[model samples]
Target chain A: MRVVKTGIAGTLESSDVMITVSENTSTGINIELHSIVEKQFGKQIRKVIKEKMEELDISDATVSVNDKGALDCTICARLEAATYRAAGIKHVRWEEK
Target chain B: MEKLRRTMLYVPGNNAGMVKDAHIYRSDSVMFDLEDSVSLSEKDSARLLIFNALKTLDYEGIETVVRINGLDTPFGVDDIKAMVRAQPDIIRIPKADSADDIKAVEVLIEKEEKLAGLKVGTIKLMAAIEGPLGVLNAYSIATASKRMIGLAIGAEDYVTNMKTKRSPGGVEILFARSQIVTAARAAGIYALDTVYSDVNNEEGFLEEVRLIKQLGFDGKSVISPRQIAPVHKIYTPSQKDIDFALRVIEVIKEANEKGSGVISLDGKMVDKPIVDRAERVIAMAKASGIQFDEEDDK
Candidate 1:
């Protein structure tokens, strides 16, 4: 799996690691996610994100996530972050456009 | 009636081998499906087989639910009529578009219950909002029936109806899932994510489960027996979570004893929301078969 950075700043929160996908590609996705806050919760990060992706049919890419200090909600936010970046949605910049 | 903490394995109503062996698979819930899995001709036999399995099989500690046909279908009424007689733990009504659909089923269930001399509310209800109309009307469906314990999406159907092809990482149904979760939570009911159909793709299924849980779903539906263990493994509360939950409970108890509405813990406010979250952790722990102290409940 290639981590293609769309060079977008869709950082949902500084504390959370976010990943997004480009909206144009709709295929099938595979993701393997792990959390660092508690290693035992490794499976949790994977399970939650997988369900969200499939329910939404995000299959154009495979996402491998290694998370540190993340909660249940952050997993979604981060995945959305990656998705938004890939979708080419412009992030709010510090300077007016 | 137990909290569905692990996998809900879906067994095709027509597949007797899978149905018989399903008990040994060790799922928290076994949903014998009468939808999608069975063809139109097999509906009657499938219903009979499911009824027999419910009546005869020894599904120890496994919640047995029948995914009945939609209210609009001819088999929908028959499926409920026969399955309700068996009195499974939960009745999963598929393709429910509104509260009216659920209410009609509830009335039928009540009628069946009375006829069978069972309790009026014996069988809990769950609806699968599978279409665009259903997704938009999720709230009404959830609140329509008191018998409803959960709401789920028919991912395949929803995807087809939306006419959006799958993306590699799954970005399409995000809005619908979030909507269902919000509606379910608002209605004070359990929200279940749809099945991950590709059984061979373990990594894909795991990621989806994680996302659904993050989206605030209580559990997920699995199409194969192999999917159950992984889902259960993820849902099992971690030691750290258990410890924190216990601590939260302890602090809340201290505050409660002192006539305080809130307490301080870990340098954060422990109000109702915090306490409620802690309670959820404990509840999930309990359902996961994790050990904890009675004082863990403030």
Candidate 2:
């Protein structure tokens, strides 16, 4: 899906991730992740972000993640929420996901 | 056996820390709130958070409940879609005024349960009678759906709806509380008292706990972890009570073995109601960590 505006979800609280999804005039998905356990878990965190975005069918968006040791589920949750908001969708179509 | 719900701790759905470690406090149940405590703006996020937590976390022994927003709001239906899919032990309906309120939620719960491929009635319901109408129809709401396991009073709203405020002894909400307890008893469901919000005032909290306990309530809802221990302490059967219950069970068993219709203990007849109370006391004793031989109780 094409993101028209900036969509933000989650928080930088402990065990949470604050994510922002915005329009990417450029092609494809771009993610910038800043996490405490970056050195050790950076690859897994990026993989989760990409995977959830793909699940939402969001192929073109600039995603920014500020994670404070969030788990994989939290990352997926934040990513999905942010992507939905960015798509300008008010009611979630849960069946699709 | 009636499940022991001495305390059901309320954990805000949006708080990542509390939601993650709520089961550790050891309350009989933990209710993650997706309504009132959560702001409208963050409703979506909180729902997602709780759904994910319930999906992944294994809260072994403690029962898990989620309080979804009312059908009156925009977020309520969506809340149901996620929570029913997550499959917590129970789904709590807030500010239910009539049987229809619960029926409305049940419709969504069943649909989602079907979609999730879980049994139709696997998820249970608990209604919080928060207004005059809800209190007046407490019996109907308690018996609304077969899935209802308990009815709880939401004193803050009930008091407000009655054009009064909560007092130390809870006199303003007495009628509402009585209706809830009576309805629950009549319907054969659990009567759960509202939360005692004053976490610091031990004496006041203790007084309220005792009042509800004496009023035939099965248990009280607690807010903090510190509150759990005190509620358990009050509900714990005393040594004397435990012994009497044990003797009552032993006598009944001996009578059964001899094929005698009449059962007596200490020259007094043991009636059905007395036996039931004895069994309940034993259940409470065992739940409170009192050890006894199972065969002896039998």
Candidate 3:
């Protein structure tokens, strides 16, 4: 899998990610994503990130995401995660700080 | 056979006015749709509205269910988490194709239940069988989760995926409908026929409902309130039918008291299964507030 770092610069407190996916005739990608934020707003934050990802129009790819107190910039990481999954790279892990 | 529901009106989660007036329509079950009815931009807001509505409103004997987004989508997981927290009587999952899909949902349901501090398995689920693959795997999907109380066909999505046209009386969906009902019955769960989309075609609508009931579906998923009265009318047991059912139950009970496993009623054999059907009829009568004879109990 190849990793491309495409970033969005904005004052938005959340992250934005844009990606394109291509896969071969072999194995498919399995992508899983999760986000952990302040418990007070964890549910709301998760809802927002998920809504964005669902809005993304992509097929033939599996995307997994994990969130840890991520702002709008986290969208880049999500795209990266999706890219990695699409490319069949399994070693890279996303962690929450 | 169960009471028929000709109209299964769908209300979007974000529509407050529709939600408020839903009960007055008196459909069999109000499906608070959060899947296609919701746009990605408004999922969060929609969830909040549905949550608040389920929490505060009284539907007066109306069954409540929420149709979550497909598991393949990001919104799907979040939809389940939020609605599960609110605890609707049932969570309807869309685009399910296999037992694995049901199991995958069960895992997430368990986690969400823990987060919400609710007992595991407290909430029930229904699967909407939409594609050919889903139809093929109907039996496995029905049995995949003990939480699954029923199975429903999704005609709009299924027809689109199969690239077929919707014919009058839903001839295109007839085969899938048959397979689903057979599967649901084999698994001992309710089989719900898909929505009749042509709201203005009442004659076509009732005809379809009759065909579905004849096919042994427990009920139907409706799309409009106007269709509900007809569906209920068709499914409700007639007085003559109810009277016969009661007699069958009485003979079965007497035989059981005498340690006989079966009995004859009006020259036909009767057993526990026959009595069970009678009980359902009685229960339906009670739920629908229909009057029945007190002597039938004996």
Candidate 4:
């Protein structure tokens, strides 16, 4: 679940969110979210990202998202895609233990 | 259950925006495409995205179909594995040439259904006969499994196999289209015509729809949202046809009650096939939101 390299997923297209996970020297996870709906759904979006990162046991990485009004499922999917790419994993087993 | 499939819209599997909002368009079926629409590197991403979208998004009871890559590609097995778990109404097999192609995917679907604890045979199959071999074996492919609900002609690959490009008149694909429709009819399944790629040409699209309707296609596969209403309009039974069908059903019911085998309407003899067609017209009319009271006939 370690971030081995810079991994990016998703697109900047409307209803999609672009996520990037890269190495960070900071002690804790750092997230920077840029979204038009930041005033309203920002907290929830960040919570989703953080929860996915935590599920992957990723505690220390710099994550950035440029969201274009993506839904909760899209956000989670993009996060999972970026996380798998960052961990150098090719296939994702969503049901895996 | 015979569902209305007049307009099956193809949305790229990788596009989250389209997937989330597809139901709003009211297409008879929203086909999440994982085949030609997706590039090589994005196959996995598209599959995963579609899986999650199916699990989370509400298609509002619209039929959800996914066109998976051919088994020749490495991605096909994984696509089936993931898609079957998501439980779409139908899985469209691309470039399917023979019964074996459908059976192979059915085997995988069976395994996935068991592993996922889904009802066996819950997911139906549709085949896209895209090449010459596929067209030649259309009937076998259409009847290969009980799970198959429809057969569609993919004209792009078909015309290429014929060494020609698509013309406005569509002379090259007439044979293939006819063959597919006949086979689907023989198999008692639906026959869906391929997409009209030129979304901007309203005249050309309507003309093609008219041709397919004349050729007895049950429905069509559509690429864009704009094509939906036109196809549905062309497929919906007219008011006259609906009225005739209701009268036919009423007469047939009366004849049955009287223990009579022969039925006639409007000085014309009515038989089983005619009654079947009439029933189909009423079904189409009802599906298209044309309401009529059956109690009125009583």
Per-candidate iRMS values, in order, are 24.3, 1.6, 13.1, 2.1
> What tens-digit string does per-residue lDDT give for candidate 1 at B135-213?
9999999999889988998777898999996664668889889999999999999898887877888888889988888
Pairwise TM-score winner, candidates 1 and 2: 2
Q: Write the per-residue lDDT of candidate 3 for residues B1-298, one digit (tens) a residue.
A: 2443334578876555666567888887888998898777546545555665676678886778899887898677777777777778888989889999989888998988887778999888889999999999999999999999899999988988889978896878988999999999999888898888889989998898889988988788877777888888888878887788778777777787898865788787776677888887777766566765677655
The positional error of residue B102 in candidate 2, measured at the CA in angstroms, is: 1.3
Kindly list the per-residue Cα lDDT of model 3 for residues A28-83, writing each as its tens digit. 33334454544565556545445544443333343434444444423433453344
Question: Candidate 4: where is the Cα deviation over 4 Å?
Answer: A94-97, B254-263
Cα deviation of A1, candidate 3, in Å: 37
Off by over 4 Å in 1: A1-97, B258-263, B294-298
Q: Candidates' DockQ values?
A: 0.01, 0.61, 0.02, 0.57
Residue B65 Cα positional deviation in candidate 4, in Å, after optimal superposition: 0.8
- CAPRI quality level assigned to candidate 4 from its DockQ score: medium
Q: Which runs of model 3 end up more than 4 angstroms from their true locations?
A: A1-97, B1-8, B251-280
Per-model C-alpha RMSD? 21.8, 2.0, 12.3, 1.9
lDDT of 4 at B134: 96
TM-score of chain B of each: 0.92, 0.94, 0.89, 0.94
TM-scores for every candidate against the unseen true structure: 0.71, 0.94, 0.70, 0.94
For candidate 2, write residues B1-298 as lDDT tens digits.
5589888999998887788888998999999999989998999988888988888888878999999999999999999888878889999999999999999999998988888677899999999999999999999999999999999999988888888988898889888888899999999999899998888999999999999999989888888999998888999998888889989988888888999887788889998898899999998888778888777788
